[model samples]
Target: MMENKPDEPVDHLSQLPVLRLNLHELAREQRTEQGQLALRDLTRLLSALVAGHAAVQTGQVDWRVRGYTHAQPGGDVQPMIELKVSAVLPLLCQRCLQPALQRVQDKVLFRLVEQEPGLTQEELEAEDEALCVRVAVDIQAMVEDQMLLALPLVPMHEVCPQPIVVAGLEAQPIDLPARASPFAALASLKKGK
Candidate 1:
């Protein structure tokens, strides 16, 4: 007979059956979870990938989530969640028009508040976000959103792999066709006059 324990952490991502996370329970238990999501599974993210790499089977994003409570002013307790995401994306290089591997890694802290508060000047500078309480959080969607934010506005290789050709400097002289100047006709007409 197989036995399952609620407190024990499950190391294998395959064992996790649920996609939505209960934030209230997660913060109460202060649980930490790590998993890998296949690139093929994220349809919206896959669409942003290069055409050739759209069907890549080995590409995946490694994500780790930790939930806990933070103490606020005036003896108030706040629920918080920290998410770390990392992934290597195969993107098209805008410079050489080829594939360039890019690694995207980010850590975001979200505070699950009963009501969202207006951002202060200091809060704007911090990476933390005030999130309203929800029934369930779609972990995959959060991971996808983070990955999308990490994508470069313009993907490029450090050094372009294509051959370079400098202007005003040629290895070979280009062939040219000889032609008479426009003033030649004027000279002929002047002579006729």
Candidate 2:
């Protein structure tokens, strides 16, 4: 059974391994010209982590992150900030299309890089360079990506609880008592005459 634990606070980035991120804090950071978005906004981040990958199964995942900070040469100045996160998430049943409610846990380590707009588009797209970029360390997006990556592609159990059964019309047998036809009765009367 999947346990519903209380949401813990996330003052630092390291705490995300427990349960993604503090959802409330992530939501606060996502406000834009558009009003508050749905929880799906955060899920999009999760999708990025799983995109082009097979579905995940339900279970708990343990993740650890190190070297989250960027540093400049010969100095302690780091322009880019990085964060690592990990967790486990429950996957829905693919067959019955029901919530399998199974929890699969895994450990993932990913980095988030801060993009500098000053760099030209070509420089940003250069090969052998980091591809993932964010305006700021959007904790919500990071947490979402982690959660999505944990979902299973085919999330059904070994045996489906409910199986479809087809009922044929012939399966229902109907019985009726035999009765003499009215024409037979008329023929008998003519013969007696």
In order, candidate lDDTs are 0.82, 0.43
Candidate 1, run of 10 with poorest lDDT: 9-18
- The lDDT leader among the candidates is 1
Relative to the true structure, candidate 2 reaches a TM of: 0.34
Q: Over the stretch 48-113, how does candidate 2's per-residue lDDT look in tens digits?
A: 333322333222233332233344588753322223344433345667654444554444433233
Q: Tell me the tens digit of each residue's lDDT in model 1 across 24-65.
A: 779889999889988866667777677666434678999998
> What is candidate 1's local distance difference test score?
0.82
| Model 1 ranges with Cα > 4 A deviation | 1-18, 119-122, 164-193
**Which residues of candidate 2, in runs, are more than 4 Å off?**
1-65, 68-91, 111-135, 163-193
